[model samples]
Target: MKIACSIHACSLSCSNLQHGGQRLLSFPLSKQRLDQSNLRTMPKRKLSQSKILGCSRNPQSAVGAPRAKNLKTGQAEEKGIGKFRFWTDARRFKGSEEKCIVQKALYEAGGVRIGGYPKASPIPGPLGFQRPEDWDFLWAPARLALKALPARPGQLVSACPGMMSLTRKRQLSMTLKGSLGEDLAFSIIPRTFSLPDELEAFKKYLEKQRSAKQVKNGSAAEEEAAGRCKELAVGNSAAASDRNDLWILKTAQHLGKGLKLVTADEAVREAAKRRLKSKKAKPYVQAQQYVANPLLIQDRKFGIRVWVLVTGLNPYRVYLHCNGLVLFSTHQYSSETWRTEEGEVALGHVTNYAQNMDGMVWDLKMLEDHLGKDAFDTLWCRIARNTAMVFSSALPQITLAHEALSVQPESTFELLGLDYLVDDQLHPWLLEVNGTPSLAVEHEDLKVEAIISKQKNEMVSDMVKTLNLASRFEPRYTSLRLAATKTKSLAAISIEGSEVEEGRSEHTAVNVMSDAADGQTTSSDPQEDEEADIAGVVQNSSMDVSTDGEVSGAAVASKNSTRQHEIRDAAEHNFTEESALHVVSGGSSKTVQTVISPADRIDHLRRQLREEMAPTTDKVVWFRVRQELQQLGGFQPLMPMFPMKSKSDQNVSGHNMPWKDRDNELVSMLGKTARLNKRAAIAAEKKP
Candidate 1:
């Protein structure tokens, strides 16, 4: 009954119970209960319980078995009551077969549970089911406890293995939780807060950046600069245009203003009027007509009509004409006055007096006579003894001008053309100065006015005054006549000499002799001799001589012959001597014989000897002797007796003569012995 109770309870409570059901059903009573009760019955009998319950027997063929009654009823039950027969031969039973059967029964009962048994395993549940005290001591306390443990080497003490394992699990869980909380605060919280803060910070940063860029670009200053450049360009262009117009206006104004005017003709006319007025105001002199007197006009077919242009009129003409007196005075006067028909004249004269008198002595003498020597010396002294000063001052300008003007064949006052009438005492009297002293025959065109304008009349007057020739003068005819006589005598002598030289037919023999003798006399004078010799040689072939004193031809021939013989003798002697020496010297004998004769040979030899023995020869002999002596001293003698050759035996004897002195005795003995031996040999040969 307990088995039936256990099975029924297990089947009812243990709806998921499997093995326990089989354990309970393995009891025999449990099988019977299972067969009887509907609560724990299976739809088919399991083979495991069939043997235990013996449900496979045939109930009809059984013999004599008692049947049981139902405990709750009084009737007897059949043996196979409430039972179905199973074919057990057809099935095999396993160990888990009964549990499988109970599982199926419980599953069919709709998840019922057995009241007295646990369903899960024997292991404890998770810490969540443990007490709270266990909560701290489990995973959480283990992590804290591990942190307090001493760390192993190469390990981090802070790392908890428990938390690491939990973190791994959470990571695994997060992998499965994908896309679940992405839009929630857990994923986007930081991004949400930082975005707004960043935006506000960015706005402030942008403001700072823009301010810095404005400082760098300088745009406000650039705009101001552009405005100023535009203003300057406009101002410059306008000023340039205004300046261009100003130049044009200034040019037009300049053209409108004309130049100051002038006329050349008006200036010339004014100058002419001034000149005319000046001429009208000046004093005038009447022109005087100069008349020619009858005597002058008759004697000279052409008479000069002279006009005297005087600076002042004279009380007496003689005083004005005192140039004649002052120029010819006997006294040594410094100043003198004389009266003339037209004027009274005062004159001054200067004289150059020089003691040297080398040059211009005649001029000095002439001047001395005009002003006496004492007065000349006085004037020269007053002028610092200067000749040029006295002459240049005392001589009039016209006189010097005339001296400067007179060209070829230079003139003095005496050669000048002037008319002065001679008085009864033969003294010349001056008339008016006539400048146009005409050489022309035509009276009408005498050029008198031109001559007066040139002031040549003043030159004539000054020249007359300088010469002092207006006074008495004498001609030098006697000196001229003496000169003429001397010239004539010289001419006659030249003609005579020329005639003689020409061999004129008119000459006598005595004259020729005289002339030839004169040549000798002329030759005595050295100067005459030189001239005559040159003349004689130049006219040698042209001369013809006829002398009274002459020599005979025979005598002349004899004299010439004697001269020739003397010359020939001297030449023969000189040539023969030269030829002999030349032959002896081993020169050409034929050439010597052709030049000299044998008759003169001795004379020639004598001459050659004399030449050789002269002082010139002495130098040669000394040189040769010294050389021979040097050779003799330097080397052995080639021969014993000086090696001389002789032309004759007498020369050998003469050679011995030099060696006879004691100093030459050895040589003399050798020479004598050699000669004696030679003589003996010659005598012996003659004896045969």
Candidate 2:
């Protein structure tokens, strides 16, 4: 499509070497337009101006609408979205886990949800809708459909692209192993060896353990070694339990489906070999070291399921839900629990919520109350620290994986369920990270179900608020925090004559139509010196193109051009405060500037002051995000836990406390900004 443009040239010149003559010249808009003998006329369809410009007549009907109308002029203009239209595939979410929460939040926020159940959202797949890009967001468990059609800009996705590196069992083990080599602070993950791939490594580890045991028993290593071993051994039972060499064999995929607790004996090793050699078997297994001394609650094994929300990947933005489930085993806890036969049960050891249907589940607050404030506080610190370290270490892997896709970090958000088990020493051990956590609350008691349901609702609501899904689209909205620091304000420019510098002119004529309509050079002959000079002057002018392709800038002339030119602002341009005629004399040190019928600069300043008195776009957004986080309805920030110095020395700055000093440049800046805002608020309150 060709845009109708009119270029008002302040100066024009042409030179022909062959003809030996100088003449006034102009270039056609396009070669194609000039060459075409027949032009196709646009169909005459009588439509409202609002409909033609893609604006809604009624503001209330503009929910989840893309374009917003100008408040003052009533013209439709492209704007940043206030609310997003989401599409969810029920097939992607298992049994209404994610679908329920997503639809509920979308309904509450006045956003539309497209393509309801039996099938997934038809926007992303191959046989999809006509305009898949119309939907602003997509919610699904897997990125299979997204891979078929890459997400376009202005579209958000509920899942991160490369999260499989952290979610998959084998990938996560390998990622953390390479990233956190000697960082013992994050050594909460147990010693794990992937079967079939790391079979030799697993054998070597077992051999080393046996050799160390033999050396401890027979050889006279040292008196100090003996004393340390004696000190480590609290009792004979504890020493025996440590020497048992217990391991859990589990599949890499699925939750609590094929868990088997077994002692690493000759029989077990031979059985593993048989399974690997078998023609029918192709199991992805992980031989993980079992936690022998688990911190039991009411003589039952338990594990904490934490909800971690990650808003970005490159520069990590992580949050933790304050309330989570403490899942308990149905049977009594025992280190000796193991499956004897092929179908024998081991419910006493595994604390999987799915497997233990009749198991007890308590909220974080309940556990905190049970353990008392001080002990729970200490335990919470460990959990938060370990969680931060894991993500910090895994950031590179996740980011690298995401690089293969077209997903934008700003448009992707993920909610991960990280499972952690506490040892007898109150140290939290990392179990696994779930990309698709279950939100189903299944219990016989109505009271427990209600409590869990309320928590999930609050979490979803807080997430929506933090994402700023309810912000209205303002076409003329200016972020003063960014604009003030980045560009000179129009109000600050003097309407009276300002002195021109030696090399720079105060006022120059800029061809707005030529620059904005199309970015092309206009010269009929390249060899002509005068024509080349004219093209150079027009090409070098600075411009700032907004998202909607609107250009805003002051015209700049050539430093060597001597001829003066009069530039007029477009009559339709609403922001034109005044028009100036520039007079540049040949080889002069300064140019004579003339301002004609200038508008009230004081009024512009007053408008800016009034806007600044209220919160700016950036300030309002920052405060809204901070407020949602600080409310702590059901969520808490994991990295910036205390907003002070970290107990561990790994923190990059005092502001982002407890977060490991890795990929923390953006995090530090945010923390500092928050602190400055807090100080400003305190100072404002104390004013007389």
| TM-score for each candidate, following the candidate numbering | 0.12, 0.60
Tens-place lDDT digits, model 2, residues 393-418: 56665565566765543556777899
Which regions in candidate 2 have their CA more than 4 angstroms from the true location? 1-82, 97-99, 119-131, 145-150, 182-186, 219-244, 266-282, 343-345, 472-634, 640-665, 669-688
For all candidates in order, the CA lDDT equals 0.23, 0.50
Per-residue lDDT tens digits for candidate 1, residues 150-235, read 22111111112212211121121121122123232112111110112133432444356445555777675764454345333322
Report the Cα lDDT for residue 378, model 1: 59
Instruction: Please tell me which predicted candidate would have the highest TM-score against the true structure.
Output: 2
**Model 1: CA > 4 A from native:** 1-396, 399-476, 498-688
Backbone clashes counted, model 1: 19
Candidate 1, which ten residues in sequence have the lowest lDDT sum? Answer: 310-319
